[model samples]
Target chain A: AQTVTQSQPEMSVQEAETVTLSCTYDTSESDYYLFWYKQPPSRQMILVIRQEAYKQQNATENRFSVNFQKAAKSFSLKISDSQLGDAAMYFCAYIGNSGYALNFGKGTSLLVTP
Target chain B: EAGVAQSPRYKIIEKRQSVAFWCNPISGHATLYWYQQILGQGPKLLIQFQNNGVVDDSQLPKDRFSAERLKGVDSTLKIQPAKLEDSAVYLCASSPLPVPVYEQYFGPGTRLTVT
Candidate 1:
């Protein structure tokens, strides 16, 4: 079974600053996908970014980027120039190439302060 | 395009009572998923459906839980004689394709409180 682990329970960053959230997973499958999702108080899970394990290059979307180290099974999300809207529960998820179901890690609550 | 839709937004029920939640996936989506998220924890996949057929229900407690995607568009999950442990948010998501190539759009979850 594949399991995702988010070590940080909570994180804080000043507005306009940068923060990195750590995530690691255990998987035997060579082909898989990693994702970061943000859930606001509204309870809607929004996709923040995603990375394909086979791709050596990391993935980035606007201010959100991932440092994906496939050999170490570590996928960390980096948020640059953080804003107040970045306050939310962030989850790291994993899904194998042959499977559709996502395995999510316990979220890390982020707080962006002015 | 509209995202996944789920209702009722909130539900309160006592132990031993039965409750049901509904979900409507985005049009043309070939896959839908149901997940249970306990407070302070990540969402756990309870079931997955490819159209109207069940693809996975390994984590779902079949003894008291039942789900159906009758028309391949709308789905319902029911809990009979609910337990206190069933208190959590139920999330519904849909993807145009079963592969991870397509993003899974999630709905505002239905929060269930079992007292």
Candidate 2:
């Protein structure tokens, strides 16, 4: 079984600053995918960014990027120039080619200060 | 493109009662998923369907929880004789088949409160 872990339970960052949320996972498979999702108060889960385990290069989506270290089984998300809208519950997820469902970690609540 | 849709944004029921939630996935999506999200925790997979066929439901509590994705489009999750511990948000997600990228789109969850 694959499990994702988000060590931080809550994080606060000032506006215009950057914050990095840490995530680690345990998986036996060599091929897998990692994802970060944001769930706002509206209860909608939105995709932030994703990284493929085979890719050596990190995945970047504008202000959201991931520092993926496959050897360490660590995938951290970096939000650059944080804004108030970044306040939400962020989840780290893992899915391997052997399964169709995504295994999610306990979320880390982020509070963006203005 | 329309995202996944879930009905009954909120539901309240007493223990031993029955409740059901609905979900409509994005058009042309070949896979649908149901998840249970407890308060202050991440969403846990309850079931997965590949075009009306069950793919993985190992985590589903079959004794009380049941789900169906008829016609491979709309889905429904039902809990019979609900328990207080079942209080949580039910989320629905969908993705296309041959998911090389495995990007899933989610819907606003249906919050269920079992008193």
Candidate 3:
């Protein structure tokens, strides 16, 4: 079984500043996928960014990026130029090739202060 | 162009009562998932289907919960005799089957409260 751990329960960042959320996972498989999802108060879950385990380079999507360390099983999210709209709950998830279900972390609430 | 669709945005039921939730995945998507999100926790997978076939259901509580995706389109999840612990936001997600990138498109979720 794979387990995702986000040590930080809550994180606050000033608008326009940068913030990094930590995540780590335990997986015996060599190839897998890592994802970051944002759930706002609207109750909608949105995909932030994703990283493939086989890729050495990190994944970037405009303001969101991920540092994926395959050997360490660590995948972290970095939000650059954080805005007020970034306030939401961020979750780290993992899914293996054998299945479609995701193993997710407890989630870290992000607060972007203006 | 529409995303995933879910019915009964909110549900309130008493314990020992049966309740069901419905989900309609995105068009052309062959995979669907049901998740339970607690108050302060991330969504937990309840069941997953790949075109009407059960792909993964290890975390699902089969004794009290049941789900079906007949004809591989829409899906329904039922909880027979609800429990307090079952109170949570139920989320549904879908993705194209056999796609190299298995990114899940999520729905707003159905909030269920068992009093």
Best model number under TM-score: 1
**Candidate 3 residue lDDT tens string, A7-87:** 999999999999999999998988888899998887679899988888889999999999888888899999999999999
TM-score of each: 0.98, 0.97, 0.96
> How many backbone collisions does model 2 have?
0
User: Which ten contiguous residues of candidate 1 chain B have the minimum total lDDT?
Assistant: B95-104
Between prediction 1 and prediction 3, the one with superior TM-score is 1
Model 1 Cα lDDT, one tens digit per residue, B37-101? 99999999999999999999999999999999998999999999899999999999999877589
Error of 3 at B35 (Å): 0.8
Off by over 4 Å in 3: B98-100
Residue-level lDDT tens digits of model 2 in A15-58 = 99999999999999999889999999976899999888888999
DockQ winner: 1
List clashing residue pairs in candidate 3. Answer: none
